[model samples]
Target: MAELRTLARPYAKAAFKAAQEHEQLAEWSQVLTIAGQVTANKSIRQLLANPGLEEQKKAELILEVAEDGVTEQVRNFFAVLAENRRLTLLPEISALFNTYRADLERTVDIEVTAAFELTDEQQQKLAQALSTKLERKVSLAASMDKSLIGGAIIRTGDLVIDASVRGKLTKLADALGS
Candidate 1:
């Protein structure tokens, strides 16, 4: 996993930079996302792995599948990836590109798991608090997790605030056992 990310970083960064310079971040994001999804299809993966398929043919197939989303810049980008045999890294590249785009837009997506459904007011308050805390626009993805028992667990990027009742109870149990 780490190795793939390491190899994908340069390509992702290059794509991000080009998109930023051209003021086409949204278009590039869409292109990468569509291309990534296309490559992840079972048949597409098999074709990509087939040694008999030419690199140009593989690139063409991907572009054809993502016809609506491809631009000239994206086409060239795919060509470069194909030529370098880094096509398998599309998923990682797309993910990293999204991270870069979010950072540039000063936005962050946070997942909030609570014991019960959150009210609109509750979600609004949480978003406001997180926006204030992170100095970024907060987009909440709320879900119910009955196992939480009570309270909520918030996750954003690498940070997690496990304030759920189940989590506290488990922590207490561990402390007592220790």
Candidate 2:
């Protein structure tokens, strides 16, 4: 998985640069997201892995599946990937591209799981607090997980705050065991 990320980084950076130069970061993001989903399909993966299939055809297949989001620039990007036999790296490239986009946009996507649903006011307060804490615009998404028992777990990027009762109990158990 790390090797795949290493191999995909250059392509992701190149795509990001192209998107920035073209002033179409959102469009490129959409195209990459669509292409990634298309490539992630099991049948599509098999098709991409077929040695007999020509590179251009592989690119075309992805483009056809994601036609709604494809632009000429993105089409050319796909062609480059296909030529280099890096089409299978679309998922990693898309992820890295989004990471780059989020950084440039000064935004973070936050996921919160709690024992119960959060009210609109609660969510707004949490988002405001997180925005101030992370110093980035927060896009908060909330979900219910009864297994949490109480409190909530907050996740954004590589950071996680496990404040749930279940998490606390697990930590207590580990401490006692130690």
Extract clashing residue pairs from model 2: none
Model 2: residue 122 alpha-carbon error in angstroms: 0.3
For candidate 2, the TM-score is 0.97
Model 1: per-residue lDDT, tens digit, 99-173?
A: 999999999999999999999999999999999999999999999999899999999999999999999999999
Q: TM-score of each candidate? A: 0.96, 0.97
Give the alpha carbon lDDT tens digit for every residue of 63-164 in model 2.
886767577888889999999999999999999999999999999999999899999999999999999999999999999999999999999978999999
Alpha-carbon local distance difference test for all models: 0.92, 0.94
Query: Which of the numbered candidates is closest to the native, going by highest lDDT?
Result: 2
Q: Which ten residues in a row have the lowest lDDT in candidate 1?
A: 63-72
Worst lDDT run of 10 residues, candidate 2, spans 62-71
User: How many pairs of residues collide in each model?
Assistant: 0, 0
